[model samples]
Target chain A: MMTLIVLGTLLYSQYRKTTSDKLKGSGNVPYYLIALLAIGMAVGDDSGMTMILPSRGLLIWFDPILEKLIE
Target chain B: MQTLRISSNQIAMLTGCFLSAGMIVSTSKEMVYQAGQDAWTGYFFPMVYGALIIVISIWLYKGREGITLFELNKKLLGGIGGSLLNLVLFWYLLSMLITDLRKLAEFVKTTLLLNTPVSVTMFMILLLTVYLTRGGIEVIARVGHLYFFLLAATIVSLPILLINEFSLANVRPVMANGLEALAKSSFMAVGSYGEVIAMISVMFAFSYQKNPKGLHPMLRGVVFGTFLLTVLSVTLIGTVGTSISARAMYPNLMLVQSIHITDFLDRLDIILVSFWVPSYIIKICLNYYVLTECISSIPSEKQNPKAYTIVLVPLVFMMGHLSFESVVELVHFETHVWSFVTVFLQVVLFSVLIVARLMRDRQRKKEVELT
Candidate 1:
């Protein structure tokens, strides 16, 4: 439901020509692409697909190494 | 960026509110755990570190009165280098936003909305943050100015309200943990205080306001924020003792829960939470605003701020959801990893900018001599 609302808003804003010059010249491609990717990941996670990589795992891979250094 | 202007006072208020909100609830427990009874004293080193950050930021701002750190990077480092540095900043700001949203969601889930999912809480907060960000910095600062007083009053009243529970004995034997313990605790505390660097991103917004003193308002705000956090640190350890506070998830919340003025006036945590929620939201909004600003400033082409806000909402929501497995992990990452990252990035950024500025000055001087 929330995803639909965000998608609807993005679509409606683009349809209304409210996007700025940069977005319009790019045909709102990047915005839609990001929206799709984010929505897909969110939906995949909701379905117990284990597709959404946890941000900590992605960002803090060096934590164990850094922890040892700090210790 | 929009040409709207806000006073230095508003900036100070926003900074103070942001710093205090970020530090008060989240860090007290860890400070206690690391510094033992002397946790309140640990802020001394952070105080010095925060002052250096502010002074360097002010010096940087003085060199380029109306330009943002993003634009400064572009001017000093050139195209590719500037974009690379901006990318690092974007990552840092986004990570901070994700962590804050997760922390707030965790707090709401554990304290207020026991049945609500963390995603719902994060989504709701992001919705409000998006709304505020779209309104731009003026609206955010106005809201900050209004709420600053209320936050100040609530924080000030904590010690008085909890006087009965406060045991000076808990904070006694000052510095008994030795300078080593205090130094280690101060290192932990520095991460939160180091957030004073966030002011640099928006210093450009202050260009329209004429202040002869120049950035003193920001320094004042940092001092005010540090003062409030110091009071909170002392109050928490005094009220609950080091053992109980270190064990509790939210030590400040625990302190508030102990407030018992009278039977009718008891259970003030709900009221206190209501006041605190807005301050925390202000912090989130400021961070979100800065992140969007960094992005908008990156592309040579002008970008729509509203579009970025809307597009990033789902991404932020997902990241917030996936950031930490539990509060313990979140706290561990922040204290151990995030601190080093912020301090290192800030130091490198400032040093490079200052060095570049000096070299530019020297080159210009040599050109003048040739002429």
Candidate 2:
């Protein structure tokens, strides 16, 4: 909860600054979205909800093959 | 918005600290396990590989003043191809950052804060990393310069302080493992040392007063770092012997715990850890800085570096949590998978870029000659 609040505040300020500066290109929407997704996943993981999959499972397939070749 | 620049000496110090800091804690045991008492000999491979990386980096930096590796890729490989390479590099660097964060957090949890949650330790470290990174590379370099001296002083004193514990016979029977086993052990160390290639991303920031010394300063830094690691490997094996050093989780920490100088000077591991934590933080800060630099240069419609840095904090936090389930898994991934990926990027991919640059240079030279 505290992590969300801090990140939310940061994202909001960034959004404000991006708009107030009237940057030439797109706004901070994409960054905000990414941050929100990441924070959600982090919160979920901390809460034992498994919002994100551990990368080890994804990369573990290659380990045995590489280990043999390296050996 | 202002351009940031750091002196060659500063970058050298930063590279030294960046390369040697974490290896002392996490990697020595693996090397000892692989090569037995001949672990110190394994550093020779990384020393050579690291020199090759520095040479190639200097070669790429020539004729391209003030341009970063991302920009150089775009220039040499065109838009789509360059961005693809950048994304690949980004993924690799992100993995590096995640691993470093987890490794440091785990070390702290095991050593100092046994009761503290890994998440809290990681969060605190990332908070510091983000704060230091926001100050830009110059700030990171300055902090590295200060910590580098302290790290060197502490590392240099390890042998002297632990002299009583030394057993010269412990490191004997060195080549009993044969040359093939020694070669295999050296291959693992290459990935750790190849991390010096991270300097390529920030090579644009190096400010040379006269004719640039090419790879001299960086190579010297790497050689010095390798020397320090060699001293550490020798000390760890010499004092603790191969069996204990290999079996211990962090042999360097164990070696430090044995520092009983006249019974008064004990618990030196605490002092060592105090100096070590900052150096590890600097390493993480550099990785974070490079990752952000890569992201900001991805030729996006919205190229906001600061926004990306802010957003990346939570993402890194999340990934750090989701990367590895345990230290054993992390070590396995590092040895088998991460080492190959890093070596491929630094050795194979950079070789491709070097060849492309050479071909382009030849074509330009021929056209000029025709004109």
Candidate 3:
């Protein structure tokens, strides 16, 4: 609803600014809806998951090779 | 749309910005890595082939001085003839834009919004691209033009993050892979430059007439863009070794993350994220604007580009969403299918257009001489 309201306001304002190209509710519907859906889906998905931290031994092994290399 | 028509220097900036497309830099890294310390050689050999690809594409562009492949098709083939060909180009570009969006989403998820939902991050980027696309091409280029400082800052700070990790020895045994490896790596670089063919459409939106000087700046921008990609490839291979760098995902970012950077800035990669997000903005908007211009060439949409953009915004969002199911699928398509399309469509189509234009030019010249 808030998204819709915001869209309405923006459309109304755009219509006012251009005057000739008046606010067609249809103007930004697809754009805004796509945005809203992407947000809903992305935010709603797993937020707590984390990539597994590499093993200590792996990091240690990497450290020596990388130490000489990165240093 | 109007913004797409930019000064040559502006196009130069875009030349650099568009390199953010994962196909060129990221895929090459993987191909090089997959192919090992031997990767660069594989890449280099291909450049000879890739240069053929670039030459074919650039020659096509050169065939016509100002017009691009899109318009050339219409002129040469007439209605259905040209539209059918360009539809392929559109699909090719749209596919790239979708995957590129995924890259942006993944980058945000891994770096800044680790805790944020992937969809939301994707949404944020879509919102920006749509808004900018609707804002017009000139605005997109202007924003791209304005972003150089941030882009440069990120590139410049890279050495600081990986300073500890780089080794001259890591890059030793340069020709260890023989000619084959070097050749392959260079072809991959050709794909990288090939992606810039989208710029021609952007050129049509902006006025290049009074200022033919635009070519010099545009070429310079491309040189700079190419230099940036080369430095990144060489640096990543040197620091991580072709072996590890090839295997690692986002080797560029990992090059940053792996560093402690004196502990306080334990993760400076986040700072660079600011630049990364916006770089995609420049790219996606440019893509959206080009798509819009292409669609508008249809008689109706020419009258009101707004309707097309409104319709295009979600279509693009959905296209981006639908193109990749998982990272594996996303990256896979990007590396193989996407690379070929990026190369062939831009290169081949333009080659056709260029030949057509040159023939036309000669006819005009001969007619003048005869008269």
Candidate 4:
């Protein structure tokens, strides 16, 4: 983790110095989505935490609604 | 900025690699578990469905000519609506990447590195993926193209090698469980094949070529990859018996394990696995590349692909490790939520976008006529 932080810092500094001006200014949502989802999936585990995503939580919330609509 | 270019054949090969990597072990078992011996029949339905969806997706993409999905969404739905849609698509891809990494890590831990930590295996994979992503898409595509023949050879030869073990009785009495069960199982396959939608991210990467090859190689890649997956599932059911194939986590590997070149040359599963590793890593690299492209599209993040790689690769590794307490929960989510996510993102969202695009075009045409 420490290694990554240092590497990230160095790389970002280098990036800022050289090619920062050329950076494209679109596609933020895709990155945000990937970051958010990756974090969500990462924190998921069997700690009985509300992680693991749209699996149990989604099913529990959705199944009843779906069943009601179907009926 | 000069963009790197690859031909249509390379695009097909990359698509084929990404499509087949995750399917080898998991997809067959799920279909067999759901549809029983009729799993093969169930698989056929989705392959067709996915093929049609792929054709439509390509049409939508080609119609726009080099526009990214992110740009298309923004154009079609204004800023916030497009951003929301992009978020949905992002979740779909991220979840898939996590799932694939976890599956691969679990397989490696169980089969190859029993004593090694799964995190280590996953981290190793992410490192390689990051390394490849740093090379940019051209390098990745060329590597995929080179390995495409080897991967194809493996897929084609595996069943032929195991032909002696196959039995008509294993897959006999198909649809004894009724068409309803078969159809239900077919729905599951959409999640697997529907991932062909991920091709959209890189579609713009192919736009500059205007390869006269048309969509033939792309379509061929989709069809051929789906065909390989279908054959793999059916062959596993035939060779391993439906019950065992359904229950076993890695029935395809099990089939390979059963291969015996000679008494002294047994235990060939590991070699088969080594051949599969490149294909699997190619898929991971494609996802990582897409992730990188996504990040680089943001002006602030675009300058240093290296920084993003250094940061996001670790996040991906950690995500795979922490995503589930056990493979069971992961598989459970995969079986249930994954298919819905793929369909919603790939089929439902794309279909709506196509319709909206058509409507907008029609409105423009009507106004032009009035003028």
1 versus 3: better lDDT goes to: 1
TM-score of each: 0.91, 0.91, 0.75, 0.85
Best by lDDT: 2
Candidate with best DockQ: 2
Per-candidate DockQ vs. reference: 0.35, 0.39, 0.04, 0.22
Superposed model 3: Cα runs more than 4 Å off? A1-71, B1-5, B20-25, B38-69, B204-215, B298-303, B362-371
lDDT by residue (A1-71, candidate 2, tens digit) is 54674477566656766675632353344455556667667566645433233345435676788778766
TM-score of 3: 0.75
lDDT measured at residue B88 in model 4 versus the true structure, 0 to 100: 68
lDDT of 4 by residue, B24-85 (tens): 75777767887888887776777776678766766666556565666677667766666667
Pairs with steric clashes in candidate 1: none
Across residues B129-236, which tens digit of lDDT does each residue of candidate 1 receive?
999988988899899898888888898888999998889999899989888778778877777777766666875545456444654777778788888888888898
State which candidate, 1 or 4, has the greater TM-score.
1
lDDT by residue for model 2 (B1-371), tens? 67778888887787788879958777778778888999899989878888887777777777786867877888888877787788778777888888899999999999999999897899899989989998888899899999999898888999999999999999998688988878877877777887776776875544554236555667778888888888888999999999988888888899889999976678878988899999989999999988877776665442645556666777787778777888887777666676677787776679779888998899999999999
Off by over 4 Å in 2: A1-13, A16-33, A36-40, A43-58, A69-71, B209-211, B300-304
| Interface RMSD values, listed in order for every candidate | 3.6, 3.7, 13.0, 6.5
> Largest TM-score belongs to which candidate?
2
Task: Give the lDDT of residue B228 in candidate 1.
Answer: 86
Error in Å for residue B319 of model 1: 0.9
